[model samples]
Target: MDPPLSFTVPQEDFLLFHQVDRDLYKILVTELSRDPSESMRLLAMWLWLEKVGFHNVVKNIMSLPIILINEIADETMLCLTCLTNNSNTSLTTIMLSSEANDIPLLQSVMENEISLKFFRQNCMEAIHGVEKTRKEVCMRAFGDIMQRAMMRNIAERMVENNNFLFGSTGPINLQFGSVGIAGALGQQHSNNNGGRGGIIPADERTLFVTFSKGYRVEEWEVREFFTMAYGDCIETLFMQETQPNEQPLFGRIIFHKVSTIDMILKGASKVKFSINRKHVWVRKFVPKRTNTDKVILPGETSGFGFGITS
Candidate 1:
């Protein structure tokens, strides 16, 4: 006995299927319409979905028409690339580009599952372009902020210790020598002193630290080390040459404020710290008023300049 079999979907079930499809379309449009900040949150959700092996859901979202895909920014595209589990496909490059408008490529990606090597190459180029644009924007914004902040005299003084302004914790190399904006400002302030080369006022505000005898150190390393110890209080540091024929072997650290110097000196008259296992001695730098002023060290009968070994 043979009986004809008939299958029919209930009317209510058919209506429910259409409702779900429409809801999904609305959700996708809403997600694409979000701002960049909100898009980042959505990206995190998409990444989680991908990690959980929700491939179909990811495919559906990514394969949206070109008009919908173009609404997303390049940053969002980069985020999407991080979740591509398929070695054969670069969904980011395929779906998030001007080439998405190409009918043949779009059809191949959507239907035939095209796997092109150039997709990865183009994706990398787009990512790099986005990064370069962001970096330039940040630098320009920072320069503008500094210009406004430095308009006031006090703020300009603050800029001396703010490494963000000069790009690092050391002196900027000028044609004359390695010097900082603080040193330049000090030189300008002391213009009234006349003829004698600009000398920074020596008090508790400055320290003359001698490195281990015969131990060589780079200028940047000294700046970085001291900056870590003193933070923004350590405005500038430079090597001092005690003898004309000898290489500069000592570092002079200048504090941004006299108060910081007083605080450090009160804790210790002389400090002993080590850099790379080599001993360093730190003492307040007291500048001599006259050329004849001299210092005598233990076991040495003749007087010499403050930092001179002999």
Candidate 2:
């Protein structure tokens, strides 16, 4: 298996817009005294629309003013918070909202195994008439691939430790095809602990929080994540969650793009071993505690991508 490539986005942008959406929903509905059961049902269905393979339903009913029904900021935040905070149920809500709007975010899932490429490709076909929508969908698909790779990487690490509790073998055992990032992670709840605390030391304890068996690392694109930089750097394919300080608490990637196969061939290129090279093709990062800021040294990356010999 090859390494996964990830994309980094400004965390503030996502959290901020989500807040606005939450406020909007709260203000519109709280005053109308709408049917509580009806509103709950709508919210549930909306989540399924994005997280589950129910995009058709979402496309059909998304036009409804579910949020506009309540206009109170507090109310909106409450609803949004509920969906965002509760992983088991709320993951669908987060996925739905993000998918409906952000094409890049949606694309991150394409790298995961849960969904066949057909759905995204169909979306491209359907939206080809609209240039703007087409571009958006394409970007979303790309982002989904990146995110899926990251999720799979994290899941693989956890599965090795038998850290996840929801599934005895592993969360990847269950197949809930087409669930978005949050939904996938949510389904694979850990028995030991929840949140990002269960990630391996190499991953800096930040959990991908998704369940999928997409961690095949030998592919070219997957190799790109490791070759682009030799130190801690953000991925271009998926967004990582941040702490309150907005610093990434999880592992960062360093990539170096290898143009000539010779660069890879001449280097010591064995997995799990280190070789000294002026340059290397790929390296699985291992963070050291020496620096206040985590940075994988050039020598370290060269050491890891150390298997290929001339």
Q: Judging by TM-score against the true structure, name the best candidate.
A: 1
> Over 4 Å off in model 1, which ranges?
1-202, 242-247, 291-310
Clashes of each: 0, 58
Error in Å for residue 182 of model 2: 42
Full-model lDDT for every candidate? 0.41, 0.29
Model 2: worst 10 consecutive residues (lDDT sum): 205-214
lDDT of 1 by residue, 83-107 (tens): 3433535454444345322222222
Winning model by lDDT:
1
lDDT of 2 by residue, 1-310 (tens): 2122122434455335334333322322332333332333334323333443444333322222331122112222333343334454543343344222122212222233222122233333322222332232222322333344446546555664563455453333322222333342222233322232322122221211111112212223333433462322222222223224532111223222221222333443212212222111122322222211233322232122211111
lDDT of 2 at 289: 23
